[model samples]
Every structure is written in C-alpha cells, then in structure tokens.
Target: MSQTRFGNQIKQATLTPFEKEVIDGCLLGDGTLTKSGKEYRLRIEHALKDREYVSWKFEKLKRLCISDVQYVSNHDSTRFGTVGHPEITVLRQKWYRPVKQVPEDLVLTPIMLAIWFMDDGTKHRDTVDISVHSFSEQSLHLLQKQVSLLGIKTTVNSDGKGKRLYILKKSYPSFKRLTKPYILKCMERKLP
Candidate 1:
C-alpha cells in the first residue's frame, strides 16, 4: 500500500494525451486556458472519476484480502466506516455468524462508538454534548448502558414529551487515538 508505487502504477497505465497534459498542468498548478488546456481540464475530470472507480476497486480487494486472512486464522471480521454496512462476520467469508461469542468487555473505541450515536440520529458536539429527539424508555435505558460501557457519564434532560438530551462528561477522543495505525496495533494479531 505504498503511495509511491500506486502513483508509479497509475503513471504506467495508458492515458489519453489530453489526460496526460491535464495531469501535468494540474501538478504544475497551471490554470488551463487554451483550447487544448480546456480539453485537458475535461480529461483531468475524467481521470479523477476513473481514479475514484479504481479506489473502490482497491477497497474491495483489500476487503477480500482481510477476509482471506480471517478465514485462514479463524478470527472474526468486523467492518466499520460510513461507506459500508456495519457487521461482524466470519473471517475471509461473506457474512456469517461467529463460532465464538464476542466478549462484552470488547468495547468499541470512542470514535467507533460515536457512529452508533450518529446512526441513532443524534447530534454530537465537541463539548461532549448530544441532542436527540424523544426516546422510548427502552431506548433511553439502552443509551445509558452503552454510555456506561464507554466509561462516559452523561446528564440527561427531558422535555416531558419523551424528548431527551444528554451531555457527555469527557472530551471526544482525539483523531490520533482513533486512527487506523493505532487501532491495528491494538487489535489482536491475526494468526499466521
């Protein structure tokens, strides 16, 4: 997953002359103006679109690799990110139930937990504050349970119509703490 290699590979791929000129112009930060430049600009846009398509292709490849590793290692596979559905499945496999139960102590990092709140349609703030529409008593109880697991204390307010708001007691986790590098290091190593 080296950017340099990826860049070289892209360079090696056949490209229209217009695309090459546009890419060159873009790299030089030269605004396109001439007739060929305009065409180059269009080609650049096309290249960008193609790049996005390629990125998606790579993502699928990575997922497949992860899945294969999981299968060989007999580990669980958990998928995160807003771009895809959330699920935990058997390693190297399409969605399947785990042979072993996930532990209750296995809490999501703060950043990952944030997704749950967002999915519930709550607005979160930097000040550890969250606002949400009315909740059912069951929903409120569930929210409290999850918050407790995250070691976060929350103060709740109700508007008497089941409407509730909660303020988090701690700072949001820093991006560095939630980054992939840190997370991968923390995860149990896959069996070789």
Candidate 2:
C-alpha cells in the first residue's frame, strides 16, 4: 500500500524548493513548528484583518492540508497549518532548540524575504523594520547578514531587551525591489 518510484520508496509529503522558501519566510514571523506525535507541522495565525494574507499562504500550502482556512470568532483571527510531516519535524529541530532560533546557515532568496516581510514587516515612513525582537543581537546579526546578500544594507538596533533589523531609508528602494512583487496586496500596508 506504500508508494515507490524507480524502485525507491517515496516518503510522505516532502516540501518543494519553493515551499521550503515559503516555510523559511513564515518561520521568520508568525509560523511555528509544532510536534504532532512523531512529526511536526507548520502553523500560522494572523489577525482577522490579515485573512487575505492567510488565504494567500493557504493557497500555496493547501496540498498539505485538509481543512480550509478557519475563522475563530473567539480570537477574531484566521489560521491554518499543514498536516504533520517528517520534513517539518526536521525543520523544527533546526529552528527551535528549546526556544526558537535562527539556524546557522540560513540562506535567503528574494521571495523568502517578501514572505518574511509580509508576516512581520512594519513600514515606518519611507523605511521598514523586520521585528525580530525575540532574537538576541548576535542572532539579528546573522539575519542582517543574510539580508545583505540581497544587496540591501540593514542595521541591527536594540531597545534594551531585543534587536530589530532596521532597513535604512536609502536601502528601501533595493529592499522594495526584491520583496514588492511577492508581497500580497492585502499586506501592502507594510510597504511605502
């Protein structure tokens, strides 16, 4: 009753390259990897106003899910998550060690950046900020370096407790160039 290809057994759902990027981006913000028995799943939640954004994610990931997007009136929020999979469990190991943390070799693409921005980015006038407050300065430095790979210069700023990756106004043009196309219209408020 199992599946095989070219005499090789095919495991349960594996993430496509694009889906991996989407997961990475989401993990940078609202996404969490939760253990479900032997596997782990990717879960996301957003305020009601961001339902369109959740729908966008669901459309990309529905192949892994059975439930439609849910509207929980009690919390007034929209939410969805993929079914448990071993691939997600592997990601959980890398992303969460007791507490969530960025992986050591986190490479990023433009679209991934867009996804991260949509989930957590805040527009401040002509500039933007990726609110990664749960991370330490060293971890923010790691992310700051990854964004630099896109040629957008960012500074890591701290507010006594945690750090934020501040994309400078001068670099907003470049940042916008990479993330604008993938940013959903529903999340356009995050852009200037």
Structural similarity to truth (TM-score) of each candidate: 0.29, 0.90
Off by over 4 Å in 1: 1-109, 117-126, 159-162, 169-192
lDDT of each: 0.31, 0.82
The RMSD (Cα, Å) of candidate 1 is 19.7
**Each prediction's RMSD to truth:** 19.7, 3.9
lDDT of 1 by residue, 54-123 (tens): 2332243332121211111232222211111111111102201121121233333443333223222233
Candidate 2: where are CA atoms >4 Å away? 1-11, 159-162
Query: What is candidate 1's TM-score against the reference?
Result: 0.29
Choose the strongest candidate by lDDT.
2
lDDT of 2 at 107: 97
